[model samples]
Target: MAPKSDSAEAIVLNFVNEQNRPLNSQNVADSLQKFNLKKAGIQKALDNLADSGKISFKEYGKQKIYLARQDQFDIPNSEELNQMKEENAQVQQQLDEQKRAISEVEGEIKNLQSNLTLEQIRHKEAKLQKEVKEMEDKLVKLRKGVTLVRPEERKAIAEMYSEKLSQWRKRKRMFKDVWDAITENLPKDLKEFKEELGLEYDEDVGVSLQSFSGLLQHGKK
Candidate 1:
């Protein structure tokens, strides 16, 4: 059902006062469409309110822009304005601090990602422990004088082991040569550079080519 003309005028007046902004007849009509007020009725109500000084308006050519009376609102004093400014400054400072804290937390997360996770560390530890256990078992067998190789296979096995060991030494030397060339002009020391690259030598893992040297010959003797 359509609102009566007087009720429509009252609705339009309340809308203008609540919005407290300059609005044309079309703006008022569109806003009041939900109230079942016709566009013509809304325009008529706006005009009546303006004529009665119930709302203020400014004429721009053929269009009139209506606004609520500013004299009805209380203006803030100078002290109140200063207090509002201080409150705004404190809120801004809190926002900046939160941003800084978020940035720091993000940096820490990136740093943790660069290092090994707990699972990876546990996996590596398990592998090293397994290797240690194998070595200990081999030592126990050797102490019991258990024959791990046939007499005929001893020479062949020793020769094969020696060849493989020589190849390993050659590869190690080649790697060291390449590493030296790469790090010749680098600012970091060799140890730090190797650490940064996660590179490890045999000695770092408690094993060395020198320690394995003459193993077969010593056993034969």
Candidate 2:
């Protein structure tokens, strides 16, 4: 059944139809800014619009912006429309291929990063494991009365092992890089770490690893 009440959505759509700017949530919000309505909630309501012919989509920056598409937008000739569609499809295809290639390269870089990180962790863990083994060996000899274990000596061993345990924990925590130089694989701990460090994470703030890597590789000239 059609919605029993579509007043709010109807209002938003009608407003868009009335003012035919390259509209976005901000535009819609700006239209309603004088009212007591929540501008943020207005954006949300518009976002929930159904795909059944009332709403239209356009990509602005990295987000989808909506507008109304109804009877009035003049129809182009079938051949020209088809040609436009074909060109759009070609561009979309090229974009998809580029994205796929970028994704593959990013995956390789992340894997390399993960592997390198794990290798470093493994090295530290190995060194700590060796220390643990060496401590156990020394304790065994001391137990046999081969040499007396001083109180400070015992404290030193305990402290060393505790430090090693803490180091291993830190390494294990950083096992994966979710944010790579490309950001396709940013560190999994990134958000938490950022939160802990009181940092803000901006989605579009920084250069992606792929672009940055390209700059480093090719920009020298």
Candidate 3:
């Protein structure tokens, strides 16, 4: 089966890398004729590769000329080299900012836990954890050079993250309701006594309400 023709994107990228020169979509499509790829597929693959930073492009009037990312590095002029250095510096700054943001969120979680009730603590912790995780995921993608330049595309990404934040909030609310209902009448003495016994709900004890209630009942007996 002619090795399954690789992928359309891979074929397009390989052809550009081998040619080591800027090529229009038609040039790419012509080169891949042996692979029986369609012009539309070749064009889409080229666009995607460029968007992902695996390939670079130049604009000539209405046409976008595509070339392999490595091709740009191979024979860099002084200006191009300086631009690459600036781009690297920007990426490093972004990484530092993401790390600082993560640390700040962690500090906030710790501070909130100090003065918050158990339910409040859990709610804040869950919300912050979700945010931190999302940031970390974005940092990884950024480190991999995933760039989204379109405003509408960025808006879609923001909406997706907002949905995730909402889901986290809903989870925190559910857990808070369950926790408040179960411990509504829990005496202060018993609460202190549970702490004294060190039967704290470590992950080993399980995270369910039943586990906590069981520990309280055991203490009473």
lDDT digits (tens) for residues 1-221 of candidate 2: 33334466667767776775567787788787665557777776677663555677777688767766756677789999999999999999999999999999999998887675766889999999999999999899988888566778977866765565566556534533433433455555666756776754323466343443354357331
Top-down TM-score ranking: 1, 3, 2
What's the residue-level lDDT of 96 in candidate 1? 100
Q: TM-scores for all candidates? A: 0.40, 0.29, 0.31
lDDT of 1 by residue, 1-221 (tens): 33354698878888998999999988888888889998888889888887887889899999889999899889899999999999999999999999999999999999999999899999999999999999999999999999878887987887888898899899999998998899889897879879989999988889888767767458742
Q: Model 3, 138: alpha-carbon shift in Å?
A: 99
Error of 2 at 98 (Å): 61
Runs in model 2 deviating more than 4 A are 1-6, 70-221
Task: Pick the winner on lDDT between candidates 2 and 3.
Answer: 3
Model 2 weakest lDDT span, ten residues long:
207-216
- Model 3 spans > 4 angstroms off: 1-5, 71-221
**Which candidate leads in TM-score?**
1
Model 3, residue pairs in steric clash: none
